[model samples]
Target: MSTFSRLGGLLLAAALPLGAQAELPAERIEPSIHAELAAHTRHFAQQIYRVAGNVHSAVGWQLGNVVMIEAPEGLIIVDTGESVSESRKIMAEFRKLSDKPVKAVVYTHFHPDHINGVQAFVSREQVERGEVHIYAHETLLQNVVAQGALVGPILGVRSAYSFGSFLPASDQEGMNAGIGPLAKAEPSSFIAPTVTFGERLDTRIAGLDVQFLHVPSEAPDEIILYLPDNRVLISAEVDQGPTLPNIHTLRGTRFRDPVQWVESLDKLRAYRAEHMVPLHGRPVSGQDKVEEVLRMTRDGIAYIHDQTVRWMNKGLTPDELVEKVKLPPHLAGYTPYLREYYGTVKHSVRQIYNGYLGWFQGDPVALDPTPPRQQAERLIALAGGREKLLLEAGNAYLKGDYQWAAELAGYAIRVDHDDKLAREIKARSFRKLGYASMNINWRNWYLMSAMELEGKLDGDAIRQRSVEMREVFLSPDMVRSFTPQSFLQNWVTRIDPQKAGDLELTLGFSFPDVDEQWALEVRRGVAQLHKGIPEGTELRLSMDKRFMETLLTGEGGLVKGALLGDVKVEGNLLEIRRFLACFDFADEAFGLTLR
Candidate 1:
């Protein structure tokens, strides 16, 4: 049987009957609502759903939902599908409804899935030439560049694990991404917004009067749109799917202000939208239901945030508050929409605490606690070392006490990474834990951890491969804006001092296309940049700005460029090669669950 079947069987065996009076442990009980609703793709996938008057949504075509508003002149596209190919498919189906030219595009947020597919609807030249306009929050560009360019290498892999990026597109493993279907990992065709707004912007585009509200919810750069004519509200990530809002996502990011998130929900509620279209998932029609969902979502967030603060005032720690602050029975409605598919109550509670109180948990012991490996070693020693711990962990796994088994095996493996038996036991434990998890993100992470332990998943390989692809795919426009000094400073700080070995080299680069010139001087693992070529440059390299961009982007790579006549060298090739080799740029991947 497949792992999914085995897991489902195990879950069924462990879980109590629905008629039972007592509550099953959160770990054992599968969230029926999430499995039922998130997996209900047949109802809308590949269908142009008429959400409300003149509004249509193409759901399940990609990671992000595409909503089209038919206006007098053309269609106002909101949050294009995740990729150019994805948008092509979605828009093909969308065109069956209407073939109007896209007058404007509104980016709901800076998330790649929401904004990267702009090239599909309109050409970059049109957007650049002011023929077509794209609007987004003022901070969207900076936020996108920061997340996609600066920290993309790290975020890319973490996101891969969280979203089951590498997992096959099947219900047996990776099926749905809480908000939408599995994201296709294709090259993102990101077109920067031509217009930006702050706070709110009321504008008429495509002969449709719309109100854009800058509501920072899932992302600080997020926004929602309201069409007064249709009484429709396009809630971007705010209502991304029906799942409980991910106030805190597993992929690391800045802490989301629960207070601000709640306020954003309120702003949407004020619209009293008869038809509510989310950036993901299906839309909701009927003024009453929309109002109810809006209110319930707001209340849920407020309950978590307000109660977390209330308990914190009583000196309750985050851990304590997470357990104590659950939705009251009256407020915890039995709606599939309110279920924790992406975010759980405990995590939301903790995030609420973190938003107010930083990572310091007030315990000095925690402030200077023993390192994880050392603590594991000490624990293993106390428990009769690796063999004893592995044996106990194995016993626990056999008894279906996966949490305990994983805990014991974790300690044993941490103390001695070569403990093969412990690693196998821990992998089994995590597999069970993953199978039992209601949150898909947790399930993916747990299963990924199990795979990592078994050497099935190579996080390092993924990171390194991602680095190469990202380097080539990163926009040249963004890279060109980087000043020589800033670029050199960043590389210099990352240089390994011990790798210097008394080597000193200088290289000059001239880019005629952009009229930019810079020279690099390296000594003892330290590097400095000079504007224009310095008089005593040991070697000189000249190339078109586009060629330089390609070299930096790893297009043909440096060696290939030199051999292919893409780059010209005026000095010794060995010297240039040696100079390039001096910089240590090894890709390093960090452990997630293992640590």
Candidate 2:
């Protein structure tokens, strides 16, 4: 059976029956803040003719529209949609625009929504036919590979929260209120580029003079392309309206450099183009409008940055900063472009602190902390009883004091796990929190956690679909940064002193389509991975790229999978097992506590 099947069966067996008791219907999500979707809708409708191509993203995500430029020599495709299915939709629309084949594809960045769907426009064979070129910033490839290694599992889990992927399409459950609709289309087979450049690359393609500017702040590998003749600037993913950047995505990843993100906006201001197209939202036309939007975006970031730094310098904690900071009236109103949809100012401020100070607030007390459960149990006893705590939390929830309600209810649940009333009250508090959040990630997390508590967990059947890892290609440097964190927990557990220097194994990983290979070495208790196979290696574990991923992720146990004949182990089997035994399983349950 497939890995998905085995995991699915196990989860399903453990799942609380859907009919155990109907969960209280999800409350209507209130739009606490304005969003950019409305403005984009109006703008796109007004400029439909200028739109060269468009694609429907999927059932649960916003639809992606593309504008293609056909020049005398070839074609320039902009803003590839989310995945293979979404890309096909774009191609179908491309047919409507013009029959010219795509000569080159320009990626805004490596975001799944923008770069995952390029294959629909042209085949790998056609690109190799020397008829097409894929263009992106120098860092784009690096970001793609780094993100690809973990995107599957992180997206697989957090996607459930962001897109309501497992929620049924019913009125009370899976309504597309959060991140609009999620793109449910199948992921495309990834295709890596045959060409790349540093700093800037000025090239002519499809009869258009394309000037690529490297912006490494928002995305280390992001590029903003300029069409000098058309006076159009493809802003890529950098300037997606005025909402705060998803600096620290809840779905999980390294912290984005917000300071550099501000710098990227300044770089974009130099373009002074008449038309600007973002990867996720509506395009801007006219120099004045583009400038206005860009200026506001810059100011928005500045406002957050300045205030955060001022407070940080004054020795304010993240919690104090969140409570004290507020946007000026000029920055407060809801503009479709400035709405907090994906990220919010409050969270962004916290991220800025984290990025600069590295989580230590210069407070020695914070260096070590008491465990949350132990503290919660003591607090519950001080509160008299779990029932009293639940009642108080429920009262607070009804009074719009969701933060306190959540805290108290959490303590009650921690104190008495079997207290169904406490769980119900806590879940209800989470529901309310979800209803009031403007950030889609926050809403999904709050709501999804509530759903799981109420015995309505969405199954993981969707992860079965195969995704071409190479399509979301990564650069060598990015791969190195990614491997350590992705497998840190597992690696830490598998180390054994007796076997420290007893094993030296080399494994080759190949992705034929992308023409990439990496040599992974296990020496002593440490793992050293490189671009090619190392010399005189005791073991040569050759395998498909995806299989290596499965092993790395701990989704497929190395020893068990090898024993089951799913993975090939060519060296000393005993050493391989010994090496595998060093890694420890991550306990996700720890996150549930307050600590």
Candidate 3:
């Protein structure tokens, strides 16, 4: 039998119990508590109740629940659902309860799910009229603007895998599994916040004493609003039940401060609210329960932080720490809440260590690394022929030893991508690992990698659309960091920096409804990125941000397109050409280089 057939049969044999397959009521929320809340508030037009998300069972991406707090002023909405569509559905349900206008909207963070559906609640004109005040942290505007163009699109594509958006909706696949329902796509629209505050802001809206706390941990732009009168706390993404917080997201981004994250948790612990509502997942009530959950969460982060640092001090490698680290029994018991649905402990610990100590773990050998493919080929040659490796890999697969199978097959495929048998074995091994992972992010990563090997990668539409690079205003540090990744030294050598002597170039980049300008100075082979207009210099280049991204990625070229006027260059055109020449196209053939 084929490997797929055998794997399919094994999965079929492990099917869930008959009770698991039976679908619950269409509109019924799970864990029963939420359903009871919905039932209790069914008849009351202006009643407040907590809706449960997938809290007790699953983790990550599953929103908690929305607070239905109706007042004589109007229906004051806290957080919309996870997506624009989900938010629309939630608003529809709210309309069923009352015909009141959504007086105001408040977002906990800039995560797509939380703030993507403002149009559903109120029109732009209503918000403009000061009738509806969309409130968030002052930094929320910066976060939204930062992610508006390229970053947003890139994240949206990766999110498909992170959230299992394309997975088959089977009980064994995409069912609630505790984190709420999974779907392929969500209709979303970005709405900029109309009002923002720096620190703590208290105001009365819709008969509620809404106190906004600028909690800069989970997200620097996140705000946790407390309705003191109702004793309800709206925590954006900061306090997510008991799960290990994603200090550094795997799909990629800046290193989140673990210390700050813990401090923020401590702040929430002191709130003393009777009820807590999170952006995703279910609500937690009762003071003791809230404290217990908060403690578990705080301790979980502390455990990873303390243990990882302890190991780091002991000269332990990242790999060594991953194997040795374990949460205590008290923390471990919160498995339902502490599952690696988003961030795995192993990865989280690594990030914590990196954030504090930097990458080098006191090992000189780790200072610079050789490419993986080159090393893999050498290892394969040392292990005899490829066929021998394949045979051993097959044995491992049959024994259900996926880790060994993956390791062997990875080496085999790296040695030769045309090796069909090795690729097949690697793909199946990854699927098995994905199937066994409770951490949804890990599952998605493994599965996505496997799909690439099998040539079944999805979500290409978003990937194909090049984002306007200029729309994202990167800080000088951010731009410097991106230089090594975006442009290689070899490409840099191609450009004659000597020809572009102390040239100052200004480019006014604008997107539809978005505007920003970059002032660049090229001198002595260094390019400095700055904001605002440039001073006197050699040239000025004007183009849309999308076109700039395409040019940088080699999908389009500056000199070739400049003639067509797709890119316009004024002043010293030759100097601009010299600057372009300084960048070398990245060597795609150099597989497994330090990323």
Candidate 4:
């Protein structure tokens, strides 16, 4: 049997006890979770699903989905899938229907899944040569780079947990991300936007009239594409299939304003689209159905946001707010599209409370609390010592109270790091919790955490994987485009002060290909770049722009590049080596839930 077939059979067996309900509550995963997961695995087949004449959806195994429009001149591609590997398959599928070249590529947003697969649609050379035009929101170029430079490493690790990026793909294990199956990371590529516009851009591409509206929902750089003649709306992440929109992703990001999101939905609802195709999931057909879904989605978000604020005015704490907020029977009855497959109402309430009211709950105890570990130590003693806590935890586990058991075990282990018995109990509790989780991200994180506790996953491996993922999305041009002040801030913070110590050196860089010359000074672990050469320089490296990019990305060693004449180094070799040693390589295996 094929892998997918074998997995499907396993899912069938696992979900035998599950009833008609598609998902269980977040506290526990039951048999039905497997059925739902299996459904997600087969959600979008490798073939095209035509929504209208000349408009088709190609669903990739990866999270992102692409829409293709067959115009008279050629083809127009909207929102490429997650990775280069997935994009290649998506492109091949498009070719099966039409052999025309991609005339234009439109970005739905600056999210990695939406825009990372650009090279698959058209080569970078084609973009530079004016053969293919890439369009995106004007803020896309800036936001993409800024997000990467600021929180790239931290977010990458969280994403691994949220998307099951590090877990093995199998029915018994990671299964799939909530939206779609996981895609390979290595085959990812990024190309800068060729053309950018603000709120609206109406133009003709491939002999087809197109309208792009910057929606600013999931990402500030988001846009919704409308093909008027076809009456199809590519609604980006605004309406992601049969799942509730992730207004606040557990994988950290800036708060998505609920008010703005509702407004974006309002604008999209005005289109009266005959078919509404979202970037992440299956498309909606019929004008009335599209409007209905958009309305429910809008109202659902507003309900969560407005109610959370209402209760906040009543002096309710975040935890109390979570329990208090719930969709009305009418809206809650709307299944599939408005259900909590990806985002839940409880989390949304917490996000709303924090986003609007800040972290303080007006509780002085929470304002300045003891560190968890220190508190755990006291808690363990108050519970009659580690042995007493373990006894209680064991009883809780026996009673199937996995959440409480895990909490007790956590306290015991934190109080004594060498508590192997406590760790084992906690790991088992995590496994049970993972199995019971309805949220796919929660499931993945719980399962991964269990494995991590058992020493099955290495932090170093996670670190390496995250670094590679970051490298795939970031490019030298993206870095260069940042204002010098922004660029310097990112660069200087990367230096390891302990490594540099008292060493002070100036390095001059001459990029002959770009005709840009700059001087970099590293003193007391502080690094800064200036436009012209500094008065006192210890060493100089002259290289083509390409070589500089490679150096910054850590693709090639400085000594190797210098030896190969890729970088021409002058002055003291010792100073160059010392300068290179000052910057610390990122710690990829940084803890998530484990530590």
Candidate 5:
């Protein structure tokens, strides 16, 4: 018996117990998880769902839905999709319901899918003039900035794999984005939030009574919106679509406290509301349906957390826990919401183990398993050299032992990274594993990694897409809160030790609009940033903070600003240019999957 069984014709395979769902027939007539994943595409067709008389949700428009709520004074938009182009189409459809101008935009959180498409609903000029107000949790700006400034490049690669962003847009290569139709890199814009709050904010928008609760869940700034007058509850990521909520995404995320997420679910349940609209899934009406979904979603998370802790107390390692923890038949076999579409018991158990105990498992040998490549080299030598290893991997693949084949191929690659045959064996093994995977994140990661291994994914194609992501992810609206201090601090890390080893110089920066002065002094091999331009500075550049911010993200308006005298340059031009060239730079040309 397998963990779950999907005979021919059934859509979901979670009808069986974990023990039963683990094994398929020795000869698989049809792959179960693959069929189920293909069937899951039905939920992602572009459609508009009317949750209530006044509230409608546009799912499949982008990674997340754009929900529109009609109010007495005007239309209040909640969650404005991911791309400007798609949101424009959604906004056009929303206009058919009512021609009311968008008065207020509520950002449930700072995910690109939630906040990136703000320009389609309201113009930056309108927001500046106070005609349209955007609302969000106060921490939204900081999180957004960190994603762009601190970790955007690495995240871009990881997200590309997890979202299958580079895969061909077809049923064979790419099907659905688990939660949505596809992952696209489109022109996106941002607007700074005008209204920010902590804990909770109770206010009236467009003549409708609304309350925003700041609960940390998927994102630290996640907030749920409640409409008292209409008895409607807008769940941001709390009710994360119709799948097992990704307590932790494979693309990498901060620790999503399962306890906090469960508590957030409880907070949503407290609102005994009649209607519910999720930013990811279809809206629900009737108190009973809402409660049922809420209860099941809550219990699914609680089950993973509690069960993992139960075994974790017995001194089990993460390796052991991934195999040990499984959803009880009730949660895994029956309900649609708890099915392993995006999140899985295997991944969540490891996260729980790490969350509670961190990287170490109280074993010194495990603590310093450093030099993993050397370790693989030694293991391969012990297994009779690279030739024998390749032979075993090929045999394993032929015998339908894909896991063993994949592991053996991994060792072969580590020993000889450029081995074409070794890479081919591993790529084939990964494709088979991907077909057997039910969680879309795991499936996509497998498929994309296989693509990278097979030389199918082009680096040139990836560079432009990653650059676009970096641009919007760290746009000016996100960096509005950054001060001269933040930008100066970044310069410390950007300094190049090899290039500036014997070169010494001082550069001063003045943001006239902000009335701030800063200086970076490079001494031999190190750089130091100070406030109020250091006395020995040889070069000083003055510009408005806005132009400076734009330059920081590489958006390119510096030439125009300099020619117009908006940016003033002082000191030796030749020396300044040489010194500036010493700093490190980043681009998407880095390896897509290989180290």
Candidate 6:
């Protein structure tokens, strides 16, 4: 479980076509959509553009772009990249252009693609020594630490599916990840910021007049960098490259308020800079071109936001709004940037509906419906029989009604989870729908779900792969960025109630090297973490800082270390085992997909 599983390549080689009708019908892939995605290959090809003056953007090197602003004495970098390995390649090329030391590093947002490459530019020692300064929004640190918290496990799975991590690296399948090329690995290097600003900050970095504004868009802590004297605007994710902006991402995100995104775009437009550099795609020069892109990007966001609200106000359900709300003809074809390669109006409209009105759309019938499997069983009965229902599904698939066929197959599956025929029919429908999808996320999710349904992927294997993603995400450098307090705080949910519910115990921890003392108190099913050691404790254990780091990074095990004399123990060493036993490390049943 330490390496990413390439499940697509491991697919059963002798697997048969999903059903007897697999070759009966032609696919309905839109030629224009396919061509549009293909054309973006050129847009994201590896290259570095001299945006304007001393500002250069290295695009297509990783999922997020990196910008370098040169100064007479040093260089300023914004958004490192997805990983140390990927950024090292780009850093080599950047060095050929400038020989100055990196004076400061700034992050556009807290997304991994933008921050994981920090060590490639400068080390933590340099920052600690006051030689290099790291700049970011004040809220960025909290979000970065949250990556290892409760929701992290599931977020990793959803992100991998959206990024096509499990798909083959071929032109027909995983050609382009829509944002940038997928990284070979998710290795990360994180450093806490040295300088953080709240809403806005104006200062001089490397002798350039710099302004950072907290504009919430793609990410909560998103900040745009503007050089007042250089007249250059670095429009981070605020202007997500040449595609329909993902006002709402399929890979689940913080509440992305469409209106707030539009407002943030307005904030960028106020700069009136002559040059605009976006993190995902090419840079734009000239006031007219920059303004057009900014306006179109914001207008596209506003159109989706307004229209969804319009229909939602009419008592329309989310499904109904999906049918009713659409972009006007002008906006739909306005610019290539508005193309639905990354985000589609279909998904965007649904999120807006949920934001305004909750999951229940005033439908009392949905309050307490029959359980899923029972309802599906009744559906099979209503359709005369299982064979007849499966037959109807095959007929619909042959007629190119893939969605309806998939729905029917789903009911059949809900009746019996292991119906081979029903699974095959559903997998067939998913393959068709995947190839016909207009957005990258939709296409990838559909294709991945098909793989899961066809027995090409094993549940146990997928679960292990998802769990291994933690190693890449919480790399050694990332683990080092956490304070003992923050690191142990994420483990609060892992307390085993069955073991610790009736027991009351306090365990003291001392790290003499780091001069940090912490304690964990378990009382009646509740676990409390304290920054300082409690006054009285039943057991006390001291650990070297280096040994503690190894434990956090998964380099060693706690029980093994205690037995190996790597940990200092006092007051009944067996109590160490008792404390460790109170936590649950057993893997849960859910993983990448619930079905």
Ranking of all predicted structures according to lDDT, beginning with the best and ending with the worst: 5, 6, 4, 1, 2, 3
For residues 1-595, write the lDDT of model 2, one tens digit per residue.
Answer: 5544543432232233322122332344332322343332333231223522321112222334455777676567765666667567656755765777778887766666666566778777887787888776666655665455534444445554555444444412333332224454444455566567778899888776778888865567788777787678777667764355565667655767767777888888888888887655566788999888887877777788889999999999899998877777676664755666666788888988988888888878778866777888888778775545655665675677877877886775665554455566566667777666666667667766776665465232323312222223332222322332243323433445465566765555444434565665667777665765556655545444455556554466656666776666567766555555544333222122222
Off by over 4 Å in 5: 1-33, 171-174, 366-370, 475-483, 499-506, 521-539, 553-582
Clashing pairs in 1: none
lDDT tens digits, residue span 1-595, model 5: 4413322111121122222113222323222347777777778788888866888899887889999889899989998888888899999988888899899999999888898888889998999999999999998877877777777787877777787776664524446767776755664578878999999999999888889998888899999899888789998889888789898888788889999999999999999889999888678789888888988888989999998999889998888988888888888864457888888888888888888889898789976685878988899889877767766776677677888988887876775666666676677778888878877898788878888877777678678657766755766666666777777777687788888999889889899888999988888878888888977677988888887777776664544776888778899888877778778865646544453
Instruction: Give lDDT tens digits, candidate 3, residues 352-413.
Output: 77788787777687677767788788887777656566667767876889889888878867
Q: Model 1, stretches more than 4 Å misplaced?
A: 1-46, 168-174, 459-493, 497-545, 556-584, 589-591
Model 3 lDDT-worst window of ten: 24-33
- The number of clashing residue pairs in each candidate reads 0, 19, 15, 4, 9, 0
Order the numbered candidates by TM-score, best leading: 6, 5, 4, 1, 2, 3
TM-scores for all predictions: 0.82, 0.78, 0.75, 0.85, 0.88, 0.88
* Cα lDDT of model 1 by residue, 245-363, tens digit: 78898877898988888899888988888999888778888999998888888888888888889999999998799779998865665355666777888988887787788888888
lDDT of each: 0.73, 0.60, 0.58, 0.75, 0.79, 0.79
lDDT of 6 at 11: 20
As a whole number from 0 to 100, the lDDT of residue 349 in candidate 6 is 88
Per-residue lDDT of candidate 6, residues 1-595 (tens digit): 2111221211221123343233222223232236567677677889999976799999888888999999767999999998788899999999999999999999888888898888999998999999999999998877877865556677777766776666654424435667676555566778889999999999988778889999999888999999877789999999998788998888787668989999999999998889999998889999988999999989999988988888777888888888897888877886568888888898898888887776888878899988988999998899877767876787676677889988988887777666766776677677777777667898888777777776666767677667656555666776666777776776678798988878788888888888999998888677899888877675877887777778776687767887898877767766667777888766553534324
Residue-by-residue lDDT tens digits, candidate 4, 1-595: 5544533442342234322222211222232254555565566455577988898887655678888899999999998776777788888888989999888898888877787777778887898899998889998877887677767788777776676666654424445556655655653466778889998999999999999998888788889889899799999888767677788998788889999999999999999999998877778899999999999999999999999889999999998999899998888768677766678888888888888888999989988799989999899789877666766776676677888988887886676654556666677778887766666767777877766665666767877767766754565545545443344346667888998889878878777776777877887878887887776775888877666556556677668988898989889888788887888755646656554
TM-score of 3: 0.75
RMSD, one per candidate, in order: 7.2, 8.7, 9.9, 7.7, 7.4, 6.0
Task: Give the worst 10-residue stretch by lDDT in candidate 1.
Answer: 16-25
Model 4 has an lDDT value of: 0.75
